[model samples]
Target: MTEGKWDEKFVVFLKKYYWDDILQLANSYPDQRSLEVDFYDLDVFDREIANELLFNPDEVMPSANNALQQIDLPVEKKLIDAKVRFIKIPNKIPNRDLRSKHLLQFVAIEGMIRKATEVRPKVLNAAFQCMRCEHVTMVPQNEIKFVEPVECENETCGRKGPFKILVNQSVFVDAQKLQIQESPENLKGGTQPQSLDVDIEDDLAGLVKPGDRVIINGVLRSHQRTTREGKSPFYDLVLHANSIEYTDLEFDELEITPEEEEEILALSRDPEIYQKVIGSIAPSIYGYEEVKEALSLQLFSGVAKHLPDGSRVRGDIHMLFMGDPGVAKSQLLRYMVKLSPRGVFASGKSASSSGLTAAAVRDDLGDGRWTLEAGALVMADMGIAAVDEMDKMSTEDKSALHEAMEQQTISVAKAGILATLKSRCALLGAANPKYGRFDRYEGIAQQINMPPALISRFDMIFVLLDTPNEDMDSKIAKHILKSHYAGELSEQRKNLPSSTITQEQVDGHMEVIKPVIDPDFLRKYVAYSRRNIFPVMEDDARDHLVKFYMDLRRMGDGKDAPVPVTARQLEALVRLAEASARLRLSNVANMDDAKRTTRIVYSCLRQVGVDPDTGAFDVDVIASGTSKSQRDRIKIVKEIIKSVGEKHPGGKAPLEEVYAEAQNQQIDRQHAEDLIARMRRSGDLIKPDKEHVKVV
Candidate 1:
């Protein structure tokens, strides 16, 4: 078709279908310079024109813009260089599938923004003044290299000479570069995720940051790869964005049919729903019933509360597993990642501080300027992040998680880029004990290599010790053997004929390890509950939680008693109760939910917070790395040293005298010696000589 005909058709189409939209754009001119037109509307108006626009955007875009300019509005001022942007284009392509055939064609691509460059002014039209004749020339710019006029535009005096740029007169627009990668959840095994560069201009430049899932409609353009030798045969693809739509809504990609929704609702109504959910998580792993229960609740997390004062209470739960080497901690974590609709699994040994949080790096598209890159936590926004081997990470690297786990945001202030990115995801971290095995006599905080402050942030901490028990060990061995047998049979069945291995034999072995609820259905169920269910605490439930908290707090009423729990545990109880209600698809948390949460919290506290010596709950064991009894003994040892040192020269007390004095204060001889050694190791007390000690 001729350009005039195409222009005439677009003008008629606009007047017929977009007259009101055009007037609105004109009223908001300069501020809203682009008018978005739906591709469906265009297709409905003229299918041929729509097809032409999809296949030949470069030719159709100019005609469409010219037609838009011809439209006259009642406003006093005319729209200056208004744009007509297409959206909801039917030709959707995956980043990995983009090919040369799709070049110059209008298509839509969906991915997460892995990196973004700062917005800067890019010249669209250059205004150059010819030095010879003092004549001004306006040249359009499109390629990376700047274009200059061959000669002067003035016909009276044409000369090829240097020209000075009139920066003020040049037409420039805000432009940014983005690197978008395919979502990890969508990739098949053994395949690396593919990424594509995108160029967004005007109002779309600063609208998206790293970790944002977006569907962008644009024309795919290719540039030849050039090296120092010359141009290479390969070409790099870049999308010139026309319009972008954010898909960051939770579980937006999980499409639940009406049948599936009904199934989920039906499952929630089952009497043994909690049991089924627990059984579904790592069913092959022998046992850790309470751990699996907590994981189940973590999937259907509590509602995030946004207070009117602008503060936010994170509803996501954080859990830590510190265990022996033979335990299946990493297996449980990997299974959770598979069950989650959106999840990222990162190993601490391989991930740096910036890799787990966010990084500011200089990329090719940034032209030496720093580009902010999203990390595992940010990529797992609104979902789950399973970090395995957390003990292998350096202290400096692990510190990066403190803010992300608490505030649900990653604040980056590197290389002039200061921005807060969302990391509202549940953390499932697994670590090993310092000595490769737990010491039942010591506090959990002392056994784990992590700091107490970080340890206290976890909603629940489970210690999976490899204790010897005949009945339990036998059951675990059987479960492991059955799982391996099932896997072997499945592999054999794939290669052997049905006659060689009957289906019944394979099914018999698989039944031992198969989950009660299908994994895919479970993932959809979790997404549905999170999206639709926001349970409010009932009066009865609230009272129950308050009573439980008070009962624990009352245990520490005496002056010498240890603190049983802190307010953090109370908040965790509330979150767990809410999650319990969500799992049942109930709108209110009742007595049952409260009771269930209390049971789980009590079990966790008994494992990690109870002081071995006193056999009493002391939150300080996890909060301060010292139990009440231990602190008291240390205080007595300090006073004894201070008084005993006065009797000797240079304020140095003999070790035997200090121990004897501590024994007189009701501390045992063995306990007193251990305290002194601990204090010496901590730098609180220094050994002045072979047999004397002095406080620093």
Candidate 2:
């Protein structure tokens, strides 16, 4: 109960468990604001003492603090109010698993900080002066709201009258509130992560930001909810943080052993590594080898570059798969999400603009202050985001991703809170064709419900048409049949008694539908490659990329022709080549890597950016509404419509006559109708009747 007597006990406690460490700390403090004591050591010293310290932290922590102050230092090194923190409890609980039994008991909790409130000065001990007797009473404020002495402590003057808080004598500490949520990877099935409030003060305040995974040693405490009706029976729990620590390694949530790293490195050295990786992704989906290869490279992305001029070149490759229904596009996206270490999967139909980027929200989590919440892209920073049903997203929501795709940043300027958050994630987006089926004659961009500007941002776009080919169809059918059989066998085995299943039967099923590499191994491999490798473009690779770009541009024939490609494609080739090199675990992209990526890019361009009639690549088809050939056709159609409308009555041209004239001009009747329909959609022409169209 006495000040110096408590200091003596603290000294004895320190001597018992940390005698040697105290000497080292005495030399380190003032420079170091705190000394971390392990709870295990305290528990080892005396179980009852540790229990008392943890269960009654308020009474015991001051002794620990006084012990720190009592340590003797050199003449010039006297420390004042140096903090003593406890960490590394024997049993740590996950944020979602906290129970009522732990209330007021010291516990270690682990989670990611989802939101943090601003640090403000909170009065810990208030000095109140009684108006009647001028008696000053020191009151400890322990509740959520500040408290004052009910009556003057002076025995002679007992009154419930007003008392002014003595500002000069009050003790305050910087305090902040944090909402810590269980990490997503820790959740089971479709369960939503649980969250709990944490109160951090003094040296621990402002120690973490949103998205940082941390472990905190604290006491779980609860307080009754206060409302207009007065204090209610409902209680809310919070962890009063004592000390906090974060993982030292980036993305340490994904644990990989040294042996696994060796296996990944060995696998990369194989000459057939590329093919193996491609085969590993969604192996049961059968076919789409080119698309699978592209997805493989996307997992091991290129090295991001920051030039001296303060501009950045992103190394993340963005890929889009616009295909027919039942082509397994969503399956591929889900596979990639499982493969990447920090992958985030979202559906455009369900995700909002703020849900996909970042939003400034005012909520109780921040105590009514505006808090910046990270979206899927931001949460997937330094990794990959797989967005399925991308075509279904509202245009307003799609606009939010423009800056995030290229610049790798999301800027929020709302609610007087301006901030820029890093996305830095490769996007693997899938969408169904707008018409519910692919049209071979239509440009890939035209089939998707996305703007040209957004379509052009993707580095590679693949169109998966579900054309009936007896040969390929049989292969896909066989693959699907085998996959279904494997699933059926798994379920049947689960239902059967132990004697009914045999290892031979399980082996038979596994052999029929197994990936070239296991999913867990693939994840570890990707993590290893991304964390260690940063490939640079070799001279020969650069030459090949430049030559490829120039050759594609030359295919346009002349300046009047539509541009075959742009600088964006050039960057894409480099990124893909670098990714290829990373896949091989090489530091330099060789000529082979360049050639492979060039072929891949060519395949993608021929699918999405080509003029189907001319059989030539035209970037305008995807970047702009019309290509050169299409533009010329539009001009001819406009002329024919004008001539026919002028020759006819009421500015209307007969549909049959227009088709006949179009056929005479070397255009098929169907092609002519398609163009006319497009023109009508563009408001260039109006159909007065089903049989007649008028020039607008």
Summed over model 1, clashes come to 0
lDDT of 1 by residue, 1-696 (tens): 899999999999999999999988888888888889999999999999999999999999999999998877787777657889998888999898998899999999998888888899999999999888889999999887789989888999788768999999999989998988897767998899999999999988898877777899999999889999999999999999999987654575678999999999999999999999999999999889999999999999888999999999999999999999989999999998878766889997889999989888878787686777789998889889999989889998899999999999999999998999899999999999988888877777788888877888899999888999999999999999989998888888888676377678999989988899999888888889888999999998899999999999998999999999999899999999999999999999999999999999999898888998989999998898889999998988998999999998899999889878777788888888888889999999999788999988
TM-score for each model = 0.78, 0.85
List the global CA lDDT of all models: 0.90, 0.85
Q: In TM-score terms, which candidate is top?
A: 2
Instruction: Please provide, for model 2 over 424-522, each residue's C-alpha lDDT reduced to its tens digit, 9 standing for 90 to 100.
Output: 999999999899998777766677789888888999999888889999999888888888987777778878776476667877887756788898888
Look at candidate 1 and tell me the lDDT of residue 400. 95
The true-structure Cα RMSD of candidate 2 reads: 4.5
The number of the candidate with the highest lDDT is 1
TM-score of 2: 0.85
Candidate 1 root-mean-square deviation in Å? 5.8
